[model samples]
Target chain A: MFQPHADRIAKPLLAAAALVCAAVLVLIIAVIISGAWPALISQDLVVFITDASWYPLEGQFGMLSMLLASLLVMMIAILLAAPMGIICAIFIAYIAPVRVQKIYRFAIALLAGMPSVVLGLWGLTVLVPLVNKWSPPGLSLLLAGIVLAVMILPTVALTSLAAFKSLPIALQQAASALGVRQHVQILKVFIPAASAAILSGMLLAMARALGETMVVLMVAGNVVQFPSGLMEPVRTLTANIALEMAYATDQHRAALFVSGLLLTAMVLVMMSFAARIKGHNDYG
Target chain B: MAEHLFQFVIWCVALLVLMVLLWLVYGLLDHGLAKLSFEFLLSEPQNAGRDGGIISILVATLLILAVTLLAALPLGLASAVWLAEFTATHHFWARKVRLALDVMAGVPSIVFGLFGYAFFGIFMGMGFSVLSGGLTLACMILPVFIRTCEIGLRGVNNSWRQGAAALGMPKIKAVWYILLPAAMPAISAGLILGIGRATAETAALMFTSGYVDRMPESVMDSGRALSVHIYDLSMNVTGGDAAAQASALLLLMIIIVLNMLAYAVTDLWLGRRLSNDLA
Candidate 1:
């Protein structure tokens, strides 16, 4: 039972295995930065980021347009999906019978399981064409955002459902005793209590939308311009890397890595925001 | 009236989401079902994936999954075991490690593709081969497996561990003999979920695995995966729609089956645990 020698080796082996998990994050950022070094060395970071014209061939490596496009789509998608996802979560959690709830949960999991490429294909063949008759050349920021909303709906719904479910049963009972209707109980008690988690869930989904590549690459038209309207095509940081990484060389290749660096940066920032809100909820 | 109206609206949104999901599955089936045949499943593609079946890519996908599991499973389980059994819940470094895993989970698959390109494809001189793709996939899925296994380990009742200790059992033996067997169902579910993720992934394999539509003779050889084949056909190949849809349908079917299995196993585990608790 008291095998000191075996314990010595076993502890370090397990510790090293755990350390590998931590080391991976460090290695990923280091690799990305080294790959992006050439682009970062040549340009002023602010001007490079703020300039809207991204002519990589002509040495103008600005990503303002794509950055804006990523932001615009993320904002619109969250705005569209959050309320619906929360409502659906409420339905599954409260309104549905146990059997029906199981079906709804399975359906959402299936939706979540659908690969991004297949979802992109669906967007291209179905949503884009449908959007085209009303708007010329259906592939646009709006289309991408809509597809993104669909992709992220289950994440938001499932997270929010957990948040809603975590509320103390006494809170619901007390509200009911005070003659609060079911909707009023949800609106006044559950929503208020779960707002932080719901917001954090939405932001987590936003982070996902920002990093998502295939759907936007297929439907966002990959145009390197600021989206003037919903109908206009736009590019994203992810799409920029995916489109150019194949044939790009030297500085151009580094520039694509820089776009990747920017994308990672943006997603990390969004995730930190989500973590902060979630942390606050855990403590308070 | 207002309360009823609010309830009605929630129901409508829920139904609408379900309908949209159904429509997508239907569209994929309708577009690809007619073309699906055993020949399509077993034969190699012709004319750059525009004319024939998806045999090579399907084989490549399975190979990649096998390789990913080989690398990820042991490392992930060891890490999860360390976190759950060796350390206290609030241990400082353990918390930091957990945070890092969480952050890694949020990093996009595309970035992992870039990492594979840099670290494995170029630096390691693997050069867009299945080995590079599989290693990158291992990194991407390690976080998922660790999270699941850690939760599973935590869900084991403390009484079992206490009983082991009271019997003067060695720590490693106790974990290996008692805890791990109990957690196998959940860990197996995690493995299935990891397979599903690897199967669905497109961006991560884009640069790491070469997009050649042939069977890989070795781990060093470049190959096409079903997900990547779908992307390549739809975007680059003219008249590739039918082939792409076929590939998508196959990918969809595999993912659905894996996910359903994971759900079923998890439910079974939970039911058993609940009954045990009552007893």
Candidate 2:
């Protein structure tokens, strides 16, 4: 039934079609670098990246503060989300009734699907104000981190759930055979066994939190200063890029591209690291 | 005592997430849903989106969705078919393609926005039009489409393929006529989820589609999307919070409906297969 000529054509055609994703990846990096070249070449790359000031009018484009804010806020977000996510995963995987488990799963999926902008709007209107009542200005690092924590919760929870669900049946049986109580088995046996997967989930969520734009953009206050406290407003690398890209010109445009490059590189590193550390027992 | 304490902590943590979820949904409905009306849905914004409605922005959002699906569908399906059917699971190029897709998925939306602005808007001379935003969005959602279509194609049973082969059917014909139809539901389910994603995206569209309030006369016209509309109102417009909240309610309702539809479709598909097995 196969035509020889058609076979030759189809194979190449399909291969070329499949290559589009790879091609697009290459194009994105190349385009971004080329766009950023004007700034990268003229300015001292080290000083431009290391200095804390970001005066675009005078062309003082240091991203040190924003970078620090991005890392600091991401760390804060992961700290808040990871424990909750892991515990939530534990509840869903082992404790919840089957019917409750189904509902929780659906709820988490719906939560994940909720747009970031809407969440940002909520953060701006509700969370920021709430934080402000206690902490003077509400749109600060703390508010951004809290919003991010909420945003990335489902990512961590879902991954941790998959990780726990894949725990070997024998391990649970062994713990039970040894006459361990349910809580003890979970703490000593299940948690220890699922730790690698839990760590993997944390890392993935860290990557997501780091890359998340809208929620933090709306609530993070977009100040390019070093965050001395969680109550102080901070600008993230992502917020910096998004806030400036539209009106940025000449050196400013290139500087934004440079930050874009940095953001892309940071995310890719986290992804690769997550991929590397991912537990093999997942999907087992 | 230690075990009880730990259990309490775990329960509290779990309940926290559930509480947050409920609070968000309930708060949006209470604060924003009251403001929503059919007039609000069908009219254009007045006073920088602080008042009136969101009909134009909704149309722009739908237009972007159309262009995104148009650009994404054929290429995504073809690649998914390639990954699922033609190549070894661990083939070098196949793995590379998969890796690229994974990396692409992780890249921040803002980066895509920059790329869209530089490549499509400036270099390609589209200049923040719906066409540019749509193409960028197409790229952004491509991984979702490919991954979903791949799963659907893989779900087509191996026995069916063997049966077709035994009947001396060409591989292409079998895939086209049998596998494609069998996987259509799952593929469409993926599309629904992708729609949720595309609808929610804001950063990527901010630069690629300039936030003009009017209905796009052509794909080349710049326009605001629902998410972008909400962002603009929240940031720039005074007393825009009310309008933003109202738009948020509509956006949330739309997303929840899409997700529910996706769940229902997948469930229905599985239920049908189970019943057929019993028969």
Which DockQ-derived CAPRI band holds candidate 2? medium
- Per-chain TM-score of chain B, candidate 2? 0.94
lDDT of 2 by residue, B1-279 (tens): 877787788778777888998989887887788779999999988888888899999999999999999988888888888888778787889888887888898889899999999899999999979999999998999888889888888877777789887897666777788888888888988889888889889999999998999989999999899999999998988888888888999999999999999999899767755664565
TM-score of chain A of 1: 0.96
Q: What is the lDDT of residue A30 in candidate 2?
A: 91
In terms of TM-score, the best-performing candidate is 1
Tens digits of per-residue lDDT for model 1, B70-89: 99998999999999988877
Per-prediction DockQ scores?
0.67, 0.61
For every model in order, the TM-score on chain A comes to 0.96, 0.94
* Best candidate (score: DockQ): 1
Q: What's the C-alpha lDDT at position A216 in model 2? A: 87
Report the C-alpha displacement of residue A119, candidate 2, in angstroms.
Answer: 1.1
